[model samples]
Target: MAARRRRDNVLVAVLAVLAVLGGGRTILGWFSTPPPGPSDDTTTKIVGRSQLAESFARDFVVTYLSASANQQDKIAEYVSSGQQVTLPSTGRQVSDPAVVFAEREVSNPQLEVWSVTISAKVGKGAGTAVGTSSSAAASTASSSGTTTSASNASATAGPGRQYYRVAVSVAAGRVRALSLPAAVDAPGRGSDLALANQNSCSPDTPFGQVVSGFLTAYLTGSGDLSRYTVPNSGMVAPAPAPFVSVETATVSTDTTGCGTGGGTARVLATVNPKATDGASPTLAYPLTMIFSAGQWQVQRIDPLPPLRNPLTVVVGDATQGPQVQSTPSSVATTSPSSAVQVPPAKQN
Candidate 1:
């Protein structure tokens, strides 16, 4: 028994020593550990959006896509010498050219890449098109064992949005293309999906009235959200609200949040918010509500919408992309285009 007690004492003493060391390191910063979270740039020590890389990448894509054979000289301003970007023979015009994704190279911090998507309204231009080389995506086989290539299939199919990815080197504060831009596919779209909120709620009902009234107060600050929500939620309306008016376009409830929801329910609503500049943008909200004091009361807005998929981690994020999640404890986010595809340089 005495031998066992000695062993136990030794083990406890070792653990106590470790605990003290750990506490000192955490409280006094003794071991010089790195920060618990990301740096001020919200990323790593080597990679960052430091050089206005997004702007340069966006401009490079726009100039490359506007490939008029006669105006190939315009590309020289973006792409480095000795490198050539394939120009579409039929001219392409791009508009609303926005950067959808930006990426940084950890191995090479001086290099940044971005993917810019242009829902360009392509129009036919009579000018000649220039391409360094030609390759066919779709080929036809003739009866004589001969093959033919149709490189202009996409060009003839019609006009629509196109996506491009380009990498830029922000070396010594000079932003230039790291390589030729390559055609990238648009984000994957989901089809035939059902959601809990179908905008079917009538504003005349008590549920609808409460949801409509709460949103109006939240956006316009004309009323108080505390009046519509359960007490102690501390939901505050924005001071000097951004919208002039809020209209409930559609609303619905999930199975648990549907019906009279005498005790508790969830309400999903779509609102048309008119900004001060007369710009009306549609917004969606996923919220929870409670029934108390013989009346319906608003609850905290859920951080995420309810998903109805069989094998899903975040179906709503994939489908109801633009929906906003608001709360003191939660934040809203959207999908980012942060990938790039760098094709090989042409031989000719």
Candidate 2:
């Protein structure tokens, strides 16, 4: 009996030791492993590469499209000599061609090659005669898949808009080469144009009042946005500080083709940037609104489109204020209107 009890005690001791060791391992594992969380490095390299590609595309397009005396040299700075093609000498100059959108895809990671699609506006310069000449040149380039001289490259590019794809190689944050521009077929208004809708709400209605109040709150950052906008509507909490003020606003309502329950509206506002220094510039803000919860709220704020007037403004700069997001399903269906038509470029 004494031997058996001693053996039992030894067995109990071994079992307890095993349990303690297992528990210790679990504790160590708990300390060793980290809980999952958002990672900043996720797609960081890809995004950086995309930005570089876009920058290269912008520089290449602007330099190639501009009919300047130093156009070839400017383009050569961004691409290889072999890639640099001589543009037509038609003196068809495009002043201030701004990039509207850019899409980049990595084609070869080892070679740092990217395929980029760019949409840009060619501001009016010299007149329709230069426009005609440039359009002709663009048509020629499109057909041959190679940059040709002014004589063979005579075709209309468009009213003042162009979309093209180019292959780019970037290394060490610099553009090494760019392929010849391949035109992307952009026939219709594309996704930039908003579908037309019938007007249902008037400026004197309560919906209009709510819209005005919402705009005031959004621009001034004075009121709670949560009270006016739906949750997850892409509006940042504690609305960003306003860099501009509304000088005048004309509200128009659109009821047709806005989905089932609600409709859309627009407020054409004349705004002035509030600069700390002297002389701030004035701009136009086409605010898209929607009827929600029996009241009007901001759906989207279209970027300042290209304007033909002397007081026209371009809001594409980094210093520009926050852009209003697209409308949520609870609000409407139609996207924002096409950017305002840009006026002719100021001559030198």
Candidate 3:
């Protein structure tokens, strides 16, 4: 009888232990952490620019624009071996070839399309029109390096200059002209940005002095450049500046008026760069001046000018390309030689 009672007790203990383990497991399930949700970050890729495609298109356009009758061989240098270009009966004078627009083909990953623009000067004689761009020759004149070759369109386009856009395709190191250049409209004009001539003061104003000084030093090599720009702006100009003199056209201010103290101001001005007599480039720049420390100083010389119409400039085409008097190796640099006179900011 004792043996039977012990066997029953053992079975009862085993059942109780199993029940305690099951209950503990159920409680633990309630406290367990839920799985983490999906991540929020989704990486997006950026496309890199291809300078080769742009450069090849630019060179091909210049040659294509200036080609005369039966010059298909010249164009074949840029196009595929079997391709031929319709040559003009008479050659047109074109200069300052610039790439106005560029984009890669999404459908053909290897190909890129570029809109190469050039300034066409008046032709001496009537020329046979083989290409579409020549269609504008009826009204074509000349441009001062007009993109106006100087970054800013000169109010005066000498020799009846007209702007031309050529669509070019580039792939694997070769450029292709699938179509002749088309004469398109000049870029639409934006809002005017002229300085308020509110006060009678012209050259004597403090701000005027600062701007004039900056330009004089930058273009004409007249004053010390260090006096006009902010410290640590890595702007550098080649020695023996590009022009003989500079004159500010219109000085404008942002929120603050030019007469009273203001934070920033833009000059709708033209400081003509009188390039040495090869082809006179249009001398103009879109520049801003800021008031810092006790006086006004030029804000900065952008590596690339703003896409909007550059501030108008009126520099007298007085001087030629100056001999690089000194090499400025210490700072970054850009020489505004084509129809514009934007000097990179000077660094100490």
Give the best candidate by lDDT: 1
After the best TM-score superposition of candidate 1, give how far the Cα of residue 295 lies from its true spot, in angstroms.
Answer: 3.9
Candidate 3 — what's its lDDT? 0.52
The digit string of per-residue lDDT tens for model 2 on 75-118 reads 66766678647677643444423333444544454557777765
TM-score of 3: 0.42
Which residues of candidate 2, in runs, are more than 4 Å off?
1-39, 67-75, 83-86, 89-91, 107-109, 119-159, 190-348
- Candidates 1 and 3: which is better by TM-score? 1
- Give the candidates in order of TM-score, highest first: 1, 3, 2
Question: Each model's TM-score?
Answer: 0.51, 0.39, 0.42
In candidate 1, which residue pairs clash?
A: 89-129, 101-337, 199-251, 257-266
Q: RMSD for all candidates, in order, please.
A: 18.7, 16.8, 17.1
How would you order the candidates by lDDT, starting with the best? 1, 3, 2
- TM-score of predicted model 1? 0.51
The local lDDT score (0 to 100) that residue 61 gets in candidate 2 is 70
Candidate 3 segments exceeding 4 Å error: 1-201, 272-285, 302-348
